[model samples]
Target chain A: MIEKTLKGKPAYWIWLAILGALIAIGWACYFRQYAFGLGLTGMSRDVSWGLYISQFTFLVGVAAGGLMLVLPYYIHNYKAFARITILGEFLAISALVMCLMFIMADLGQPLRGLNVIFFPTPHSMLFWDMCVLWGYLLLNVLCGWVILTAERKQVPPPKWIYIFVAISIPFAVSIHTVTAMLYCGLPGRHFWLSAIIAPRFLASAFAAGPSLILIACLVMRKYADFDAGKEAISKLTTIIMYAVIINTFFFLLEFFVGYYSEVPGHIHSLQYLFFGLEHNGEVYNNLVPFMWVATLFNFTGLGILAYMKIFKVFDYRLVGTAAVLIFLALWTDKGLGFVFAGFVPNPLEEVTEYIPTLNELGITIGVWATGFFLLTLLYKIAIGVEHEVEQ
Target chain B: MMDNKRRKFLKMAGATVLAGISAPAIVKLSSTDAVASGGGQEAAAGGHSQSAAGASSARIRLGMVVDMRVFYQDQALLDVAIEACVKAHNIPEIPDRKSEIKWIWKTGYENAFPEHSHNHRSQILEHNQFAVLCNHCDNPSCVKACPTKATFVVEKNGIVAMDFHRCIGCRFCMAACPFGARSFNWQDPRPFIKRYNPDFPTRMRGVVEKCNFCGERLALGLEPACVEACKGTGALVFGDLNDADSEIRKVLDEEFTIQRKPSAGTIPSVFYIV
Candidate 1:
């Protein structure tokens, strides 16, 4: 089973080598951060949380998005999804690895990381988030490993694997909900306190997760002589189309409530994100550009997906392009827009902008590389098992 | 006259440390508390430990009432108070505004009372610089956010305390504090501490810290260093809120007082008299 991932073309090894170099550089940069302090990053007294935390928030959605496929195939018994369910599960395992890595990179004291567990605080949302994340990661690892191994042996998976599958269905939803709760429960941060934050997270997760998988499936089809079938691809495109609509609708609802309610606490962050908030006669709207770009991408991606669904067109390239657009839009909206909105015009009605330094960016890229490295291996093994068993 | 008293107080604290009357676990081999300055937060005399003996009665809710009129009249009074606190606690003087650590700070009405600053307000209120520090809330959001119990409210004294060694420096507390009270040591703080107070310890990098309501001073049967510095000014008052006859309670009852972000439901122990 392990040998499948080891045997690859020169292009594959070259890609791995590049990632290996990035991982090495990222770790080297992290060591410098550890020796110095978080001062190496662009975060400050007002904008306390920056790139690492925002990235953690976005990737949690990506990990939770894997459940869209798992729930449909296992519970609803959607046969069209059977060909790609393994892809979703493997993607989850890879994304969770990145999620955990980003969290470690953000910690001020990574060595005392166990303190969260050593002093298990049930009252804290972080305590619950840690519990749910590890639980979700373990469940996906078990489900993916067992299902794929069983497929290669040409036998049915253990009857008990469904119980884990059943648990993971809710686990997927729980991870994003718990992650949102981390921000929402803080009374001071008005931007994160929405009742629909968890739902918004799930919507974006559904959109982003499948978008990446759709693009990955297309890549696998071209590079590895593997086809996930036309029906499965079309079904996934429709799922992404609906997810994008829901995600965009959720954003519009936030916009309506922020402006219509006319609450300064509620509107300040949104104002800062979209148009820039004025503080002390200086307009502190650094996030304005990225946020506007996200808004454009979201509506444009939404328009394209809606048009495709209505026309009943599923050309691989057209759908692939839409998926890329939707994925980037959600990533920026949450990663760039949401987290900064929470901190700008900080508690004191003062603005302190955050811009990640090169060192922080290096560590971030390293963490992402590690995640992709895991992903490439998992996908390779899953596909190899499929090829060996299908023959 | 006050300078002599401050020197005497520092000498006594130094003498106590030299005599080694405290538990060996005290952060500094001197009786300095961990939260006050240095390491071994879970060890004795780290602010939360019962070793802070005389004031360990759980019934007492410590509180402060700020009379802004005194500071408004003589701004130097406020400056002296801030200097006293920074010196006693060894707060780093980081040049970068973002990374600077503060136990107490001054802000105008626009920042001090963000909710009330919009409309045409009092010129007097607008001019006076309000002193802000940790609210040490009765129901603190930071206590709930900390992944590790590094920061917790001491039930006995009703004071929020930090264990520097235990803090993983996640900065969740910074976000949880509505008043922007907490500061993270972004760089090694040792270099920035200009005047080392042997009576207190200095913290390392990568930990969150803020005003402890002078818990270490209270342990030594002295008022907080800031209160002591402002003794004659009538600007800053510290007393046990639970005590019916305490000065803070009387001040609160008589004056029109306010707390930062009352709607956040933190129930700040610190109050301001407009």
Candidate 2:
């Protein structure tokens, strides 16, 4: 089963080589960060978190997005999803690995990260986030391995696997909820301190996670003799459409509250991200263009999906394009705008702009490469087993 | 037979659940006790004579009041107090403002009281340089956010303190702090220190540090370095807020004081009379 990943075509090997090289370069950059401190990054006292944490937050959503397929298949007994559920689980495993790596990159003392476990503070949301993330990762590995192996052997998975699946349904939700709480519980960070953050995180996760899977399915059908089935794809399209709508609505609710109340603390971050903020006759807003791009992509993606739903259009190409757009839109919104907004008007009311240094970008690229590398291997194994069973 | 097997499985499951739930609770209780005892030993080892005298008494809530009017009159007095604090604490003098670690710093009234500052505000209030430090809040968000108990409120004196050795420097405390009181040593602070106080210890790279309300000095029956330096100038006052006769409480009673982001509900011990 493990050797299945080694027996791929020339293109597969080339793709793996590219990811490996990127990972190597990323590690080289990370060692520099370790030798120096986070000072190597563009983060300052004002902007303590940078690209690393933002990526961590975004990937957690991507990881949680796996449940969009998991819940429908396992809980709803949707047989159409059985063909692709393993892919979702493997995607989660890869995303979570990247999430943990991103966290390690962000920590001031990466070696002492175990202190979080050794001296656990339940009061801190970070402690719970660690617990849930590790738990979710374990659940996915166990479930995916057992189910895929059973399929290869042409047997029904043991009844106990269903229990793990049930637990993972809520466990998946917990991972993103706890991640959101990491930001929301902080008192001073007005952008993240909203009760709506958890729901918004889930909505975006459901939208982006399945969209990634749809794109993966398309690639699998093209290259690996695996089809996620048209029924599964259409169901996912419906799920993405509704989830994207809910995500947009939740964001608008936040905008309404921030702008309508006109509280400086609540509005300042939003103003800085969307429109440039003017302080002491100096306009400081580097995020304006990124914010507008995300807004355009998100709504346009939503409009495309809504049109498909109304017209009952089942064109996979158009839906796939929309999925790609939605994926990028949420990725930018969560990974770029969301994290930066929380720290923009630093607690001292000083606007210290943050632009990621090349080193930071290198390290981030390395983490993403690592995730994709693992993802390719995991998908190879899963698709190999499915192909063997089909034969 | 089926009933017996079902009963056996249920009992086993319930017992496992009970054990799992109780295990963390027990550890939590014991750790809390450990922390309480550890605080006692710290005070004893540090030999805070004043705390020893009041060991059996009610917990003291230490507070500070800054008279911005005095600092406004003579900016040098503010610098004197800050210099004294930096010297007494061995705070690093990182030349780069991006990575600077500050125990106390000067900022304009607009930055200090951003919510209060509006367009067309008086020039005096706008231009006034106010000294801001950790408020040592009764409900400190930093202590609550610290995963390792590295930043905690002292049980004896209510001073928010840091155990630099234990800090993993996640900087969650920095984010949690509404007052921007905490600072992370982004690099080795030793080389950056222009004047190191041998009595005070310099922190390592990758640990957050902030104003500990001069907890070490108060332990030795002495005033905070900043308070002592500003004594004649009357710009800074430090006292037990719980004690009615303390100067901090007296000033609070006589003057209408404002706290930084009081609406945040941190119950900041530091007050200002603008």
Best by lDDT: 2
Residue-wise lDDT of candidate 1 within A1-391, one digit each (tens)?
Answer: 8899899988789889999999998999999999998999998989888888888899989889898899889999999998799999988888888888888888888888999988888888888999999999999999999999999999999999999999999999999999999988888788998988999999999989998998889988988777999988888878887888888788889889989999888899989888988877889888888888887887787777778778877688887778888888899988878887799788888888888999999999998899889999988999899889888
Clash pairs of candidate 2?
B48-B219
lDDT of 1 by residue, B18-74 (tens): 333335454243334443433244234343444444343335677888899888788
Worst 10 residues of 2 chain A by lDDT: A312-321
The worst-scoring run of ten residues by lDDT in candidate 1 chain A lies at: A300-309
Candidate 1 wrong stretches, greater than 4 Å: B1-58
Q: Model 2: per-residue lDDT, tens digit, A352-373?
A: 8899999999999999999999
Q: Would you list the C-alpha lDDT of every candidate in the order shown? A: 0.84, 0.84
Estimate the Cα RMSD of every predicted model relative to the unseen true structure.
3.7, 11.6
Residue A356 in model 2: shift from native, Å? 0.5
Candidate 1: docking tier: medium
